[model samples]
Target: MIKTNTIKSVGLKVPALTFGASGIGNLFHKLSNADAIGIAEGAIEMGWHAFDVAPHYGSSLAEIRLGLALRTLDRDEFVLSTKVGRLLMPRQESGLQNGEEFYDENPFNRVYDYSYDGIMRSYEDSIRRLGTRRIDILYVHDIGKYAHGDIPQEREYFKTLCNSGFKALEELKKSGHIKAYGIGANETEIMMEAMDYTDMDVVLLANRYNMLEPNRDEFFAKCEKRNVSVAAAAVFASGVLVKKNISEGHYEYGKVPKKVFARVVEISKVCDRHDVPIGAAAIQFPLRNKNVVSVVCGVTSIEQVRKNYEWAQWDIPECLWKELAEIGIK
Candidate 1:
């Protein structure tokens, strides 16, 4: 097994790589319970200590799976981060809240909720669901995008959550119930905006900084100055970086347009020049910077985890990076 390293940027020292649970929850497809647990456990055994899951993923089933896997590990060994904005509620059975009757469904089927009450409820519910004293990090998920309907009304919901969630998370940090507070979403602009409202220690950004485009320059500069660590996902661009014709919907992992594919083809040639696989280049590209401390790549199986972890071990030459830049990644 390859030993993992830690990035001591934020207040907490976390594994350089994390297992993003969105895919394992089978937002891609219904993953078997055993398979999810197996891959999650495999990540831990591989010396990875950071796990990122969100309620929006698999309709809250991702966290349930994470909690179940963590139950077997010594509590102090790992760092877990879950997002809010979409709260989880227990199924009501005969007027009684069905605590154990977990189902993966977002009640309103709404995009974002940041209400103060909703934020508190989300924190409380996550604690109950994970059966943990607290989460290491709680993010204001999808903080950038507004819901489709009711702009003013919907903004109020997110604002309430921001006001309540950040304060509550701060108190949780002080009380030792939470370790850190950050934002997690697929939006780059929103992550940068958090610097304005809150002094968070970490941010999880997906799709913004990947092999196709490295759009984190402004955020990277800010994080370096403030010591905020970034945990990136979707490095494969929803599995499009590796193969052509990726799927559509849910995180924009669809096939890179032929125009974009043109860039990747050139990138592949550059990686070929460097004598490395495109996969290896993709895995190592973001971490080349000092500001991006860790990357939480999504893994659907034990094999994918091993492949990613393996690629992470190899250091891509700076020459390859320069060559990639020449291919017009900008």
Candidate 2:
């Protein structure tokens, strides 16, 4: 069985591997209700009861589908989390295009609002969509320059979060509306800056602490020092680490660059020599770090869910880590 860890500050014990809900929201392909619920049920059966969802997923389809999946389960049996930032507003005249990769989703364009009122409205909306009485964790989603290409706009949003949005999260936590609150960002610098603004219990750091980009040692060290636990999201580096051929898949949600591809090739060679799947190594790498409490992976089908569970549990030789360090993945 997969293990679990406690985020002591929030008093939540989550599975070592949390299920990411993006794929169930019909990312890239349309998903039937049965298929989405079945995959989630399969993950629960396999002992992964923690799930992470967002309004941005499948044009707000992820939270709805996850709600349907967990409707019958007792609330205390699992841990649930969703992000607040993008508010889904229903349009009276419907002609909105779904998310770029999402097909056949609902008609609603997300409005990015991080004000106090916006955060409260987003939280209440998420509760309705998720069909849950309370959320265990709430994250301020995509508040970094990496997510918002405009640096000045990102800075302004960060300031808004510090000045007003953070109060809503803290109030929710204190009032028992949410157990923990933090910023869900893909970059480390902004998270460090967030620490200066507010005391967060957890941070969902995505795509940065993976096998290809293990450059956040200092960041993790600082988090440890501050007693801020981190959850690893996008641990497969978006796709390259898990794909059968590294070149066939994208990295950091886009085409892979030559320098990054070269490093992955070396890591792949070492995995081949050790008779270990690269996916197994990638899924296991973050758990070895002291600061990472959980690793979340996105899955669409039951087969993918099973494969991810198996990969997470797969055995890797200690020598592979040494070899990877030699290849510059350290």
Candidate 3:
């Protein structure tokens, strides 16, 4: 079984590893129903009961599939989280929505809604799609410049979140609709800005505080000081850290840049010298900080699930971390 820790701000104990549902959402590729459900069931069997999904993933397809898998299990046996901000609307014509990363998605177009009513509606819709009474952790998804770019609309969305959306999250916690609420974002700057606006119980930070890029010390320190827990996602840096060859992996969901590939090559060499799998080191890196409660990783197959579990459990010598530190990977 994976170890568990309490998210002190919310008093929720989650596994050190969270099953990110993007894979089942058909990110980059499609999956058969059997395959999607099997991956969820397999993860549960492996004692990975904490799951994080978003409506933005396959426009609720992932939530639907995950619900099917979890329907038979005791609801109390697992911790569930899902994101808001992107409400699903029925698409009139659908083959593929433009600019979407998910493949073979459900026939729904996503609308970015960050108002009070939008958050409440999004939460209720997620509950129905997930077939759950309440979500343990509710995140406001992609409310930053990373998703919206450095535009005036970005500030408008942030204003909506600060002025009205945050009230919805606070009310949900008070009403027991959700245990905790925070922002689920890939960037750290906006999250830091949000810290000044409201008291968030947790933050689902992705790609910012992982093995390949671990220079978010100031952000993690702020989270720790504010008593805000962090759920670290994209710990693989979108598969770059785990790939055998640096060129074969991706960084930030795109082609690996030359400098990043070079850095990973260096990190990989150090891990090889220590007789350690670079993937294992990646899986275990973020948890070194006290405030990070979970490392969320997405997997598309049962084999990938098994591999991640093994990597998460792998033992790396302490000297390896020192070596990585020398190479500016700490």
Quick one: best TM-score, which candidate?
Answer: 3
**Candidate 3 Cα misplacement greater than 4 A, ranges:** 98-100
Model 2 C-alpha lDDT per residue in residues 69-90, reported as the tens digit of each score? 8886799988898999888877
Off-target runs (Cα >4 Å) in candidate 2 are 92-98
Candidate 1, residues 1-330, lDDT tens digits: the string is 433444344357777777788866566465777888888888878776778887766666677787888887887887888887876544443432222222333332424557656766787877776777778888878766632244676466546755666777677677877777888877766666667777787887878888877766777887777767777788877777776442332336433476666666777778888898788888777777766767888887888888888887876787888878776553
Query: For residues 71-147, what per-residue lDDT tens digits would candidate 3 score against the true structure?
Result: 87798999999999998888897476733578888888889999999999999999999999889999999989899
Candidate 2 TM-score over all chains jointly:
0.94
Residue-level error in angstroms, candidate 2, position 323? 1.8
Candidate 1: segments with Cα more than 4 A from true spot: 1-10, 90-112, 146-150, 244-251
TM-score head-to-head 1 vs 2, winner: 2
Candidates' TM-scores? Answer: 0.85, 0.94, 0.97
| Count of backbone collisions in candidate 3 | 0
- Report, for every candidate in turn, its global Cα lDDT versus the true structure: 0.71, 0.86, 0.89
Clashes of each: 3, 0, 0
